[model samples]
Structure formats: C-alpha cells, structure tokens
Target chain A: MRNEFHADLQTVSQLLVELAQEVRAAMRQATRALLTADRRAAEAVIAGDRDIDHRYRDVEERVCELLARQAPVASDLRAMITALHVAADLERMGDLADHVAKTALRRHPSPAVPAELRPVFTDMAGVADRMAEKIATVLASPDAELAAELDRDDDAMDELHKGLFGVVLGADWPYGVETAIDATLLGRFYERFADHAVNAGEHVVYLITGHPTPS
Target chain B: MRNEFHADLQTVSQLLVELAQEVRAAMRQATRALLTADRRAAEAVIAGDRDIDHRYRDVEERVCELLARQAPVASDLRAMITALHVAADLERMGDLADHVAKTALRRHPSPAVPAELRPVFTDMAGVADRMAEKIATVLASPDAELAAELDRDDDAMDELHKGLFGVVLGADWPYGVETAIDATLLGRFYERFADHAVNAGEHVVYLITGHPTPS
Candidate 1:
C-alpha cells in the first residue's frame, strides 16, 4: 500500500508538469497572437484553454482521491497539497493567456498593441515565456535554487511592465485614450501572467525545502 | 473521532466566515481611501491586510491539518476542499483591496478618481460593498439562492466596469494619460474584487448543493 501511494503521488506530480507545459504553450501562442494580430492563433489559444481547465480538474480530483485513500502525512502531505496549489496557478496562467487572446480577438485585423510599444511588449512576452518554461522545469525537478532563479526572471517582467507605464504616461504620448486603455490592460495581463509563474515556482521551492519563499 | 472531525470542520468554516468579514471591511475602507484620498484610511487598510493574510494562512493550515488527519470523504471532503478554495478567494480579495489602497497612497492628497468620474466610482464602491456583505451572509448560511443572487450583483459591477471603458474611450475624455492609467487600473481592481466575491459565493452554493455554478 505504501508503494502504491508513492506511485500515485508520482503520477500526480507528472500530471501537474504536463499542465504547466500546456500553459506555457498557451502563453506563447497567445503572445504571438497579440504581437502579430494573428486571429487564428488567438482563437487557438482561447479554445485551447478548455483543455487546460480539464487537465486542472483531473489533477485536482486525483490529488483529492489520493489524500482520501492514502492519508499522506508530513512530506507526503505537503507534496499533495503543493500539487493542488501549483495546478491552480497553472490554470490561472492559462486564463491570463486567454485574456490576452481575447484582447487580440477584440481588436482583430488591427493589432491590440500599437507599433511604437511592440518592442516593449515583445520583450515582455519573451520574459513571460522564459518564466513559464522555468516553471515547468522547477515543477519537474523541484530544485530550490532553480526555483529561486525564476523570481529574478519575474523582476525583468516587472521592469518591462513599468517601462510600458513610462511610455503611456510620457508627454510625447500620441496614442488616444482607446490605445492607452488597451496597452494598460495588455501590460497588466502579461505582468500578472509572470507573477503567477513566480508563484508556482515559489510553491515548488516550498515543496522541496519545507520553507516558504518571499512573495 | 467522527464528532471531533466534524467539530474541527465547523471551526474551519467559522474561520473562513471571519476572514470574509475582514475582507469586506478592507474593501470598504480601501474604496473610501481611493475616492476621498484619505491617506490615513489608505495606510490603515494597507497595514490591516497583514492581519487578513495571517487569517488566511491560519484557515489554510487548519484545512490542511483536517484533511490529513481526518481523511474526510464524500460531503465532508467536498466541504473541506470548498473551504480551501473559498479561503483563497478571500485572500485574493484582500490583496485587491491592498492594491486599491496602494494606488490611493501613491497619489496621496490627489484623489485617484477624477472629480468627473467620482460618481461612477462611488457607484462601483457601493456595488462592491453590497457584494462583499452578501458574500459574508452566504458563507455563514450556504444558501444556493443567496449565492445565485451574488451573480446578479456582479452584473451590476460589470456594467460599472464597462461604463468606465465608455468614459475613457469616449471623444470627450479630458484626463491626461496618468489619470487614465490610474482610472483603468482602479476600475479593474474593483471589478476583480467583485468577481472574487462572486466566486466565494459560488463556492458556497457548491458546498450546499453539490453542483458547480456557472463561472
């Protein structure tokens, strides 16, 4: 029975990793849709979110079943609980990507991001994609050091988010209120996406070290 | 042993209700600070959030301990899981209020909501307060009907959120970029706060009826 419990725990961990990978892909495609005005890509990301949601529910139910059947304690209990939290973070990340995609769809045929701000958003997207990839790695390996590194990656995203504010708030701003609103919302979506990745990474660190990471 | 487990579950529920009340008060004070530029109120809300976080952690640990020790199944398991989800939503609501308070703090003595948009924001705050109060009631009683009413209340908030977009996107928008950014972000914080309240309500409904509510 102990061996079976351990095997179930391993399966739950693998499922969470798989969910993280799907979320990473969703963010990548959503970013592409936002930057390039690709309606098809945006639609794909929005549609793909249901699959991520389904996977999240599956992993959650599995974890609950494991807890009920095995009643894991100490480190084993922590692992099960952490899996639930990580899955939630990944699901929220997927939703953020969907928000980005919806923005792309709303402004279809005309990119949501203006050309002048494209470079900044491109950089933001790059940072977010890297953060998501690192989250997947941390979930799979559970390395405290590597998980800590993801926080530094998130700092870069924050800088980019602030840079966006500078552009919008500058005296030279030429975009109308509509564009300003779009830019503000889009920047927030990316910043929040990176934040959730950092959260998932921190959970990984906690699961490994049994100590909480600073938010 | 069964009686002890049930008693622990009751304690956890009470803790969540208490957290909900605290979150409601935080939102009310934060909104006041934003509209009136009350620095002291803003500071108080910001400082008060730590207590909310502590309560959230307390509730989370209690639920985790209950699950590990009791191994609750069926309705009992669902109630425990719902409590975890509800506590998370409450914690997030507190953070949203904190965000609003920080926005107020950053623009001290210079109210974040412009005079022209004050009425709209005032209305938004009213809806948010109502929603929060209703969430507390639903948490205490777990009535599916009351929980369903929270969704209609959220509809009011959505209208206000869209009204904000209309004002910002209109040709008559006179505010500069900075104010526009502040308004947009503030509007989003309020909308999201209400959304989380609705989520907590839905979780209550789920807890009572064993059926998922529409997202």
Candidate 2:
C-alpha cells in the first residue's frame, strides 16, 4: 500500500509537468498571435484552453482521491496539497494566455499593439515564454534553488511592465484611448502570466523545502 | 472519533464564514476609499489584508490536518476540499480590494474615477458591497438557491464593466492616456472582484448540491 501511494504521488507530479508543457505552448502561441495578428493562432489558443481546464480538473480529482484513499501525512500530504495549487496556477496562466488571444481576435487584421510599443511587447513575450519553460523544468524536478531562480526571472517581466507605463504616460504618447487601453491590458496579461509562473515556482519550493515563499 | 471529525468540520465551516465577513468589510472599505480618495481608509484596507491572509492559512492548515488525521471520504471529503477553494476565492477578493485601494492611494487627494464616471463607480461599489454581503450569507448557510442568486447579481457588475469600455473607447473620450489606463484597470478590478464573489458562490452551490458550476 505504501508503494502504491508513492506511485500515485509520482503520477501526480507527472500530470503537473504535462500541464505545464501545455500551458507553455498556449502562452507562446498566444504571444505570437498577439504580435503578428494571426487570427488562426489566436483562435487556436482560445480553443486550446478547454483542454487545459480539463487537465486541471483531472489533477484536482486525482489529488482528492489520493487524500481520501491514502491519507498521506507530513511531506506526502504537503506534496498533494501543493499539486492542487500548482495546477491552479498553471490553469490561470492558460487563462491569461487566452485573454491575450481574445484581445488579438477582437482587434483582428489590425494588431492590438501599436508599432512603437511592439518592441516592448516582443520583449515581454520573450520573457514570459522563458518563464513558462522554466516553470515546467522546476515542476518536473521541484528544486528549491531552481524555484528561487524563477522568482528572480520574474523581476525582469515586472521591469518590462513598468516600462510600458512610462511609454503610455510619456509626453510623446501618440496612441488614442482605445490603443492605450489595449496596450495597458496586454502588458498586464504578460505580467500576470509571469506572476503566476512565479507562484507555481513558490509552491514547488514549498514542496521541496517546507518553507513557503512569499509572493 | 467520528464525532470529533464532524466537530472539526463544523469549526472549519465557522472559520470560513468569519473569513467571509472580514473580506466583505475589507472590500467595502476599499471601495469607499477608492471613491472618496480616503487615504486613511485605503491604508487601513491594505494593512487589514495581512489578517485575512493569516486566516486563510489557518483554515488551510486545519483542513489539511483534518484530511490527514480523519481521512474523511464522500461528502465529508468534498466539503473540506471545497472549503479550501472557497477560502482561496475569499483571499483573492481581499487582494482585489487592496488593488483598488492602492489605485486610490496612487491618485491621492484626487479620485481615480473622473467626475463624469463617478456615478458609475458609485454604482459598482454599491453592487460589489451588496454581493460581498450576500456571499457571507450564502456561505454561512450553504444554500444552493442563495448561491445561484449571486450570479444574477454579478450580471449588473458585468454590465457596468462593459459600459466602462464603451465610455473609454467612445470617440468622445476626453480623458488623456493616463486617465484612460487608470479607468480601464479600475473597471477590471471591480469586475474581477464580482467574478471572484460569483466563484465563491459557485463553490457554495457545489458544497450543497454536489454539482460543479461552470466557471
């Protein structure tokens, strides 16, 4: 019975890693859609979110089943609980990516981001993609050191987000209200995506070290 | 042993209700601060969030402890797991309210909503406060009927959120880029607050009826 429980725990970890991979693809595609005005890509990201949600519910049910059957204690209990949170964060990241896709869809044909601000968004998309990849890596291994590194990586995204504000509120601002709203919301989507990745990393760190990292 | 487990479950329920009440107060004060630009009220709301987080962690730890020790199954297991999700939603609502308060602080001595949009924000604040109060009531009783009503109540906030987009994106928008960005973010904060309230309501509905509401 103990071996069986450990096997189930391993399955849970594998499921989370798979979900992380899906989230990374969605985010990458969503960023590409946003930057290039690819309607098909945007639609695909929006449609793909259903799959992520399904995976999230699956992970959740499995966690509950494990708790009910094995009644895991101590570190084992924490692992199961942390899995629930990590899945939730990944699901939320998927949703944020979908939001970005919807923005692209809404402004179809004409890109939502202005040409001048394109570089900032491009940089943001790159950072967000890297963060998602790192999230997947850390989830698979649950390394405390690697998890802390994810937090530091997220700081770059935050700086990029702040720089967006400077461009929008600067004296030379040329975009109209509509574009301003779009840029602000778009920046937020990427920033929040990174934030959730950091959150998942913190959960991983907690699972490994038993020390909860403050968001 | 069964009686003791049931008693612990009751304590979990009571703790959740108490946390819901605190969330309601924080949201209410935060709204008031945003509309009135009350720095003191905003500061109070910001400071008060730590307490909410503490309560949330307390509830979570207790639930984990119960699951590990009692190995609750069937309805009992479902209730404890649902409690975790509901507490998380309440904590997020508190964070949204804090975001609103920070917006007020950022624009201190001057309201975040322009004079023309004040009435709209006033209506939103009123609706959000009412929703929080209803959430507390439904959580205390776990009534599926009351839980369903919260969704309809949220429709009004959604309408308000849509109306904000129309106002901001309208050709007659006289606000500058900074103000437009502020208005957009502020509108989203309120909309998301109501959305989280609805999510909490859905959790209550599930707890009572065992039917998961579509998120």
Flag regions of model 1 displaced more than 4 Å: none
Point out the worst 10-residue segment of candidate 2 chain A by lDDT. Answer: A138-147
**Native-referenced TM-scores of chain A, all candidate models:** 0.98, 0.97
Q: What is the alpha-carbon lDDT of model 2 when measured against the actual structure?
A: 0.89
lDDT of candidate 2 over A1-215, digit per residue (tens): 88999899989889999999999999889988988999999999999999999999999999999988998888898888899999999999999999999999999999998888999999999988888888889877767887788877789999999999999899988877888899999998999899898889888888888888865
Per-candidate Cα lDDT values, in order, are: 0.90, 0.89
Docking class of 2: high
Counting only residues 3 or more apart in sequence or on different chains, how many pairs clash (N, Cα, C under 3 Å) in candidate 1? 0
Estimate, for each residue in B1-215, the C-alpha lDDT of model 1 and write its tens digit. 88999899889988988999999999999989998899999999999999999999899899889887888887898888889889999999999999999999999988888887888889998998888888888877777897898899899999999998888777888987788888999999999999898888888888898888876
Docking class of 1: medium
How well is each residue in B99-132 modelled by candidate 2, as lDDT tens digits? 9999999999988878878888888888888888
DockQ, all candidates in order: 0.74, 0.81
